[model samples]
Target: MTSQKLSIINISYKNDESVRVLTAVLSKWFSNPKTLHFTSPNLKYPFNINHWISTFYNEDNIETYILKDENWIIGHISVKIDENKNLAHLFHLFIDNENRQKGYAKKLIRYVEKHIIAGKDNIKAINLNCVKKNIPAITLYQSIGFQILKEKKWLKMIKYIDKK
Candidate 1:
C-alpha cells in the first residue's frame, strides 16, 4: 500500500479536456514497449494523439476512470464493455510509477467489476490480455483469482471471471 491517497472517478466521452490530460499522462507512462503497447495495431508511444482523440470521441462502449491524488492526476483505467459476450474487458490499465504499489490497482479493479456487475445483466467475465513477460501483472491477476486458461506467444491469455 502507498502512502499517497487517491480517488477514482468515471469519465464521460464528452469530456475532451479530461481525455487529453489522460492521454498525456498515459503517453508518458507507456512511452516504452517494455511497459505497455497496443496489442492489436502493435504501436508504441508516443502513441498517435489523433488516434487516441478519435477513440475517446467515438467509442461508445469505452469508459475511462481517473485516479486523482488531491489536485494531481496519477492514473486511469480504460474499460470496454462487450455486451454481446457479456464481458467487460480492461483495455488500458496504467498507474503512474510513483503512485504504484499502493492499493489503487486493486481498487480500480474492484470499481470496474462492480460497474460491470451493475451495468450488465449477465456479464460472465472481465477479460484482459496481458503480455506474458509482465510478471507483476500476471501475479496480480492470479492473486485476484484470475486463472490463465490459454496462452499465446507474448500475446493472448484468457481468464474467465470467477463470479462469486
Candidate 2:
C-alpha cells in the first residue's frame, strides 16, 4: 500500500480566523481530560477555549504548525524560542487519535528540526518535556537524537541543533 505525504501549514496568530480554526482543533483534542492534563499540565480541566487561545495565541515567541494529509489534519506542534537563552522549546505536540502510529509525529518533528532550527544560528538546542509514562513519545524523541536530561518527574529531552 502506498502512503500519503503530509504538509506542514504554518499558522499566523495575527489572523483571528486562522486562530479560531487552530483553537477549535486544540479544543477538540483537549476535550479529553486525560489528554488535557497530559499535554498541558498547568491548565485546568473542562478545556476552556478562551484560556487555550490566551495561552498559545498570545505568546509572541511561539509558532504553531499543523500537519495535514490533503484531506485531514494529522497532528499539531509548536516551537517556542528563547532568544536570550538561545534555546528552542517544543510544545503541544499531539497527533490525532485516529492518525496515531502512522509516522506523522516523526515527520512533524523532523520538519521543525530541519526547517525551523537547523539554519538558525542563535538556536543552540531544542528541548521538550515528555511525561515519563508516555513511552511512545519518549521513544520518538530518543530515536530522533533527543537525549534524556536529568529530570525525574518528566523526562526532559534535548537535541542540539548544529548550525550549518
Candidate 3:
C-alpha cells in the first residue's frame, strides 16, 4: 500500500445483483476450510443466499464496507455500533487471496475507524474476536492498537478511541 487513497463503499443498503455477486464471492472465500476456520463467522461455509441477504440489509445498526484497490475488490469489513453500550463491534474483515500482505488490511481497518465509526455518538471502544491460532490477523490487530481483552474460547480484542 502506498500513500494513494483507497476506495471504499457501503454495500449493506442494497439487495440486488451486486449484493448477489457479493454473496457468491463471500461464500467461495469462506468455503475454503482454512479461511472458514480463521474468520469463524456465524454463517456456515456456502451459506444460504437468502439468509445472508436478509442479514445484510435488515441489520439496522451495522454497515458493511467493501475496500477496493482502485477498480479491484480487495476486501470487505463490517462494523456494528451499539449506542446504549457506547461501543462498536468489528467483524467479517477479509482480504482476497492476492491482496494479502500488502497493508490493505490495515488501511481498511483504519478507514473504517476514522471514517465510519469514530464520529458515531459516544462510541468509546471498538472490539473484535478472532481465533488465537490466526497469528497474522492477531498481530495485525495488535499493531493497529487493538489489545487483547480476553483469552477464553475465542480471543477478543479492543481499542479505545477518542472522539475529540
Candidate 4:
C-alpha cells in the first residue's frame, strides 16, 4: 500500500457541493446491507450521517478524498487520525464498484502514509477498526504490512511509524 501507482491522482477532502456528492457516494457504498453492516465492528445499527460527519469533519480529523476522472467523482476514501492515541485510523475506504482492482486503495493508503503520517513528527502507528467478518480487508491489510496488535471479536491493527 505504501508504494503503488495511485500517485497520479490527487487525494483530498471534498467541499461545497462536493460534500453532497460525496455523501451520495457514501450512501451508495452503504447500500449493500452486508457490506455496511459488517464493515465496522461494535457500530450500533442505524448509523447516523450527522454523527459520522461530526466525528471526522467536525474536529477536522476525518478526511474524504475523491478519485476524479476529469470532473466526476469516481470513488473516495475517508481517514481519521487520532492524535490522542497517535493512531491514523482508516474510517472508510471504498472505490466505485466499477473502478475496483485499479489499486486505488493502495495508492490512497500510501498517500496517507507519506503525507499524513510522515508529514507529522510524533505519530506512533496507524490503527484502524475492522469487523472480524471482513476477511478481504484483513488480508489486504496484512499484505500491506499491518499486523494484529490485538484481536477480540474485532481487530485493532497497528503499523508502527519510524520515530527518528
Ranking, TM-score, top scorer first: 2, 3, 1, 4
lDDT of candidates 1 onward, in order: 0.69, 0.83, 0.81, 0.67
Q: Which ten-residue region of model 3 has the weakest summed lDDT? A: 40-49
Shift of residue 161 alpha carbon in model 4, Å: 1.3
The regions of model 2 sitting more than 4 angstroms off are 1-5
Model 4 has an lDDT value of 0.67
Report the C-alpha lDDT of model 1 over 16-40, residue by residue, as the tens digit. 7866776677667767766655332
Highest-lDDT candidate: 2
lDDT (Cα, 0-100) at 104 in candidate 3: 78
lDDT of residue 107 for candidate 2 = 87
The residue ranges of model 4 lying beyond 4 angstroms of the native Cα positions read: 1-16, 41-48
Model 1 residue 63 CA deviation (Å) reads 0.9
Report the lDDT tens digits of candidate 3 across residue range 3-69.
3456888775464866766876777777786786676556566566676656545778888888876
What is the per-residue lDDT of model 4 for residues 42-110, given as tens digits with 9 covering 90 to 100?
Answer: 344455555556545665666666666555555566667778877778767666677667766677777
Assess every candidate by TM-score. Answer: 0.82, 0.89, 0.87, 0.78
